[model samples]
Target: MSIDGNLLTLSQWLSPAFPVGAFTYSHGLEAAIEAGWVHDVVSLQNWLETVLDQGSGRSDAIWIRSAMSDDANLSDLDTLARAYLPAAERLREAERQGAAFVKTVNAVWYTSFPDLLLPLAVGAAAQRQRMDGDAVVALYLNAFIGNLVSAAQRLMPLGQTPAQQVVSAMTPLCLRLTVATRGASPDDLWSNAFLSDIAAMKHETLQPRLFQS
Candidate 1:
């Protein structure tokens, strides 16, 4: 694909309209809102900033780039991704979305690859197409964080404008991680956003929940 074509493909894959069912998972922002940890735009931004910087968001970026590498062992990578999930709901969220992504992309893009973890599936697909690695990882995080912000709108009083503003502020962090993770490997993956991880586990038992995780 040409540069323009690659850009278009990335946009479609990461777009809100993509059939990955991303909107249904909040990464536990729903539960966080109930606990008063993420009750407003600023708090929400802080929560997500930590996620992108020190949580699964950063970890997923590394996995994506790892899957894109020439010598990637996808089965091992997928297994590792599953092993690191902090909660059962988090595991379900990643598995279902990753499966849907692989099924759709295989039928639409005309290829065959086993269903893998979400980040790994995306990375392998991007590698197959020779897509830009930076764009792939950046936009994947963009969509991931953006979906959570959208979920926050329903879980809290955050309006569309404020929600988008949060996404805008988060854009730089996403881009910076893409650049930083260009040479990253899964061995370097880490998740220290304890609050986010705890929130994801908490969501498993949250009453009157509006999100899956």
Candidate 2:
């Protein structure tokens, strides 16, 4: 595909209407909000950036790179992704969204590649569509974070301008994460955000929750 085609494909995947159930998962942001860790716009932005930097950015990026390189070992990467989910609800969210994404891509972009986890499927799609690896990774990361920010705004009372600013502020960090993951390995996938994990775990039992975590 040409660069224009690649850009269009990236836009589709990164769009909020992609139908991968992204809007349904806040990656625990909703839980954070209820817990008061993300009561304001700035706190929400910091929470999201921390997740993109210390949590998903570090672990999922490594998984994407590993799956891209070792197609035969995709299962191992998937298993690792699964294991990294410290909460039951979070695990189910990842697996559910991942299966949906893989099915969609297989039906549309049908390659001989094996079924992939969420990050891996995204990476594979980027590769097949000839999108720039770093660009695709950054786009996905930002979109993922953007979804959380959007969810927070709706769940809370964050203003439109503040929400957009939060998303804008994340751009540089997304670029840095994409560049940093260039040499990352599967073994590098790790997160120490136990409080977030605990909140997600607690969310599973929270009465009347808005997000799947």
Candidate 3:
């Protein structure tokens, strides 16, 4: 496929309309909103910046890049990805979405992606398709952050324009992380987004929750 064709495929895989059910999971942003930790645009941006810089956002990107390697150990990576999660809700969030992504991709593209975490599943698929690693990880982060921004809109009084602004503001940081983590190994897969971890844990008990966590 041409370069344009690869970009088109990546865009579709990471698009909001993908069957991965990404919109259903907010990575605990719902709990943060309820707790007033992210009640406005500034706070939301701050919260997201931390995640992208030092949390699952960063770690998940590493996982994706690692999985995109030709010699990637998909089974082991999936196991580690499951264990690296901080909360059961988070594990389920990654697991269920990943399963859906794998199923849809397999059905449509005829690739074999075992049940893996969301990042690993996406990585393995991208590897098989010969997509660019940096672009794959970058767009994965974009979709990840985009979904959270979308969730914030539904959970709060945020408007479409502002929601877009958040994603826009996050683009450079996402790209930076992707660049920084290039050629990174699983040893570099670490997340210190503690508050987000707590939020995901707390989300399990949040009453009248709007997200699946």
Estimate every model's Cα lDDT from 0 to 1.
0.89, 0.77, 0.91
Ranking by TM-score: 3, 1, 2
- Model 3 lDDT tens row, 100-169: 9899999999987788888998888888889989989899899889999999999998999999999999
TM-scores for the candidates: 0.96, 0.92, 0.97
Runs of candidate 3 with Cα error greater than 4 angstroms are 1-3
The TM-score of candidate 2 is: 0.92
Give RMSD to native, each candidate. Answer: 1.5, 2.0, 1.3
lDDT of 2 at 70: 36
Q: Give residue 35's error in model 2 in angstroms.
A: 1.3
Clashing pairs in 2: none
TM-score of 1: 0.96
**Per-residue lDDT for 58 in model 3?**
94
Compute the lDDT of residue 69 as modeled in candidate 3.
83
lDDT of 1: 0.89
